[model samples]
Target chain A: MENFEPVIVAFCCHYCAYTAADMAGTQRLTYPSNVKIIRVPCSCKVDALHLVKAFEKGADGVYVAGCLKGDCHFNNGNDRAASRVAYVKKYLEELGIESERLAMFRMSAGMGFQFAQTAKDMTEKIRELGPSPINVAKAQLKGEAA
Target chain B: MITAERKPLEEIIACVAPFRKVLLVGCNECVTVCAAGGRKEVGLLASGLHMALLQQGKSVEIREHTLERQCDPEYVEELNSLIDGADAVLSMACGCGVQTIAGRYKDKPVFPAVNTKFMGASERQGVWAERCQGCGNCLLGQTGGICPIARCAKRLMNGPCGGSTKGSCEIDPDTDCAWQLIWDRLKALGLTENYVEMIPAKDWRTSIGNGPRKIIREDLAE
Candidate 1:
């Protein structure tokens, strides 16, 4: 049987994390290509619904990388995003999905190393957790013979 | 600025136990602003119900619909098509909206997903504070805009009970002394003379006690 490659959705802030991700590319940092990046104007723009939609769309792991504390492009944007991420984490737990699947990180636009570390750490953690339990049940419900 | 919170998931599930095809209806008015029932809450409740039904091995066709204001007839009229497809409606609107939905759709069973608590405002974020008893009498002109009917531990119209100490109520230390607040505000506005005005016991007949109060605009009704 082929190994399940976990799908990861990384919401990268347009101003900082996205640029840092680009910098990681330019610096030739090697990380798993399974991480799909979505750019938003600010991390605060990512609401609880967006996180739920990501999970519904089959993301095994999700992360919101924003500016460091007090460095939000929009004042307190990262703070708002952090609170929402925490709130969504609780909802995920209530939904029987592991809260670790959702993560919030802070990084400067210059921290390509930190970005790479986050990617490696999250991939390895999700790998250890195995395929999401909800996904397993969902595949069975549809009778696709996974 | 009415404050509201969602009813527990188990309670909501129990209310819709008989329905197979359930439409989880949500209101985007007071409930929405308070984060109890809105488009976002509709999604949460719908997912919750789906999971619950799935666990019971009972398949429920779940759908979600939110109206701009469920209490108003115009927005509820927009629900005709969605309501037609569902076996029952689980309304997240307040008490008034629930009754309105039932009245509007005589044939369908409408269930309330939220227990309407009170006519109150937010004291702080996610904290709802009751401010009005709907006494039908304007007492704020005398009490410095604070309603003792709702705020006081004992609904003393004349003055504070003996439990008040250091400008806080003894019933709960966290609460501010209602009469103290009234006195301070009255003093600030140079309106202490209003406190001396001996107001009689409130006439509650004009309020909800007499049942189903109605206001008809005679000139505009035609």
Candidate 2:
């Protein structure tokens, strides 16, 4: 019901998006606390399995935040992550999960506002989508009304 | 190496939709090298199915197992202890592996997760091209080692068929005319005389025309 709070997982690249998240903290920008950030070596390190596993572990939404195109610290890490995120999005749709639950974004360490904006946007979108189907199933399995 | 491609995800998911528990078997031989049914792929698929089935509230127990070679009985025997634990087996091997597993356990159902593609060689990384037809005939010596049966758009014996232009096949611009390759090969070997000689009609008895074919060597029989 209206009390539902969506869970979101964000895989942020250490060189860019992760640093941006730290910047947002220093700037005192407020974003949904439910969006948990996992700092990865590079956006490319965020594999398709990790995204799906997040849902399996009860996350309602997942996002991969990498450096802007051609700005990857490792010279194409963000490019690779962008495509991998696309692949996972299609894979999730086929698996019966809403494609809106998974996403990818590009940002720089200087874009603290953008990082906060992405967090707020993802939280809003996932809240509208309600809790993930996996979470609903898990709740039902425990004989509780979701 | 034998090549295969993973079957569409929906089809594979549907095949085990009836089962509450399933065993996922991957082969380490050809499928692994081809990036189709390898151990890593098995893990990817198993986790995916687990997540999907969980969302449906279907408590499906999916287990993962990888064999050195699914086509070999010795390796397949490894599944003997685990087979009974699952309702069905989903094989991520080629057709031969699927059949081998099915034959080993006649009582259990075996489903294929990949479609066997061909007897081919890797053209490059992640790219495969057919190079052998296994016509029960070895004619590579005559065609400058390029297989006409497999490479030719039309399995022509004495050809170019006049449809070839600039050494490319008429069927597709990317396809090289097999006869052009044969000519280039024969010329390089100074065997132009052999090119003009008739190859004669192939004996159909040695091929699939004689039903299934096999090599029965009594000397090597166990």
Candidate 3:
């Protein structure tokens, strides 16, 4: 018997998290293969709709990774994204989902260990939480598509 | 612009709980500007509602559409094709937009997802305050451009009521008396003499005293 695996989506900003992800590869770090990364120009570009849509598409967990506070490549982009992330978390709770499923993480481009650790931790957390509520419908839809 | 705030998620969920399918409509006008309802919001809401129902062991089909402006019949006409299979409509526009859709689709139940707040201006980012009451009259000419009808707590026409103290409204210490604002503007414009002329009693007929109001222009009619 095999253990349950989780699908986690990570929105990484170009200036920081995305670069860290590359650095992690260079350093030969290994993280869960289920962590799908989407590169965005800046963390602020990740809209609330995008977060919700990720879940709707059957992502068991989602995270926004950007530069550390006050360190955004585009001044205050990370700060603005932080506020949006907090607001989305509250909204997710109201939607009757676990707020912990969505989170905003801050790191620098040189922090390859942090990037690998984030992917590992998010995968473990989601594995424990099991599949998202919409996972069943998503699976059915996939079956129909097949 | 008409301002609105989204209703609590529970209330919106309750409205569509009975239906197996719903069409969530968003407006691209005032409600969008206020960050209450827009295209992005429509998608977010559709996802939220879907997940909420999914958690309850229910499978519901939700559709999302945002019109150019929901208050206009031309823009609303776009929904006719999409509304055929939906059980109910959850509108994210102002009260006028909700009524427009309800009036158009008489058979389908149209529910409002936001509370129509007021015809007002945003004081700052994400903050709105009442500015106009739409009393069907233009008294700004005489009151130094400050509207007493909307700003005044009692809607006093002549001067400050006895309740006013220290240039603030009696209702709340934080609120500035509308008449005081009128006086200050009048003083700055050297039009303080306008106060001496006693204004006559207002004609309530122009307001909501009668019923729902309508404006028809024969020349502009198609």
Top of the candidates by lDDT = 3
lDDT of 1 by residue, B1-222 (tens): 555667776677677777788888888899897788889988877775665555444467878889998988878998888888888988888988888899999998988888777788877776787788777876888899888888888888988888899999988888888899999999999999989988797888887678988779999775
Give the fraction of reference interface contacts each candidate recovers. 0.07, 0.57, 0.83
DockQ of all candidate complexes: 0.26, 0.51, 0.54
Better of 1 and 3 by lDDT: 3
In model 2, which regions exceed 4 Å deviation? A144-146, B55-57, B161-198, B204-206, B215-221
For candidate 2, list the clashing residue pairs, or say none: none
TM-score of 2: 0.86
Which CAPRI category fits model 3? medium
* Model 2 lDDT per residue over B12-90, tens place: 8889889988999999999999988999778778877877777666777889999999998889999989999989999
| Candidates 1 and 2, the one with greater TM-score | 1
Candidate 3 on A38-138: residue-level lDDT in tens? 99999999999899889888788999999998899899999888899999999889887788899999999999999999999999988888777678555
Error of 2 at A134 (Å): 2.6
- Return the interface RMSD of model 2: 1.7
Q: For each candidate, give the interface RMSD after superposing the true interface residues on Cα.
A: 2.8, 1.7, 2.6
lDDT (CA) for every model shown? Answer: 0.83, 0.89, 0.90
